[model samples]
Target: MNSIISEGVQVSVETFYQPDYSNPVQSEFMFAYRITLENHNAFPVKLHRRNWQIFDSNGSHREVEGEGVVGVQPTIQPGESYQYVSGCNLRTEMGKMKGTYQMENLNNKQMFTVDIPSFEMIVPMKNN
Candidate 1:
């Protein structure tokens, strides 16, 4: 797991390779990642959008931008957290992902960007 704190918000990530969904013979690899967002500010924050940068060992890259995470904008209160699991498909067995979340402070309507720590996705066997 990897974690980072940005603008009073903490983002943690854990990644796993899904062998069942991957077809190495065809150069397709699937990975699932769990992200935990923690609000440390005194006010509540609502996630508005998400932007991700994905990289594969084969020199392939993808950028994904969308409204909210997993299809919903979640409000997280101080000392509270929101967690979700999402998947990514890559052309290689090794890859990485990093991104940011656009959040708004419900109390003051202040918008800020929260960094989602970069994490690696590698087949378990590759760790050796």
Candidate 2:
């Protein structure tokens, strides 16, 4: 797992390789990632958007930008947290992801960007 804190918000990530969903022969590799977002601020905040940069060992790159995560905009109170799981597909067994979340402070409606720490995804066998 990897974690990063920005402006009182903490983002942690855990990755897993989905062998069953991948076909190496076809150059398809699947990976799942779980994210935990924690707010340590004095006010509540809502996650409004997300942006990601995905890189594969084969030199493929992907940029993903969307509203909210997993289809819902969640409001997290001070000292509270939210978690979600998402997946990605890569053309190689090794890859990495990193990004940011756009959040709005409910107290003053001010927006801020929280860093999502970079994490790598590699097949277990590849680690050998």
In model 1, the runs with Cα more than 4 Å from the true position are: none
Residue range 1-128, candidate 2, lDDT tens digits: 89999989999999999999999999999999999999999999999999999999989899999999999999999999999999999999899999999999999999999999999999889998
Model 1 lDDT tens row, 1-128: 99999999999999988999999999999999999999999999999999999999988899999999998999999999999999999998899999999999999998999999989999999989
Please provide TM-scores, in order, for all candidate models, with all chains considered together: 0.98, 0.98
Give the clash count for each candidate: 0, 0
Q: Candidate 2 at 37: error in angstroms?
A: 0.3
Q: Write down the worst ten-residue block by lDDT for model 2.
A: 119-128
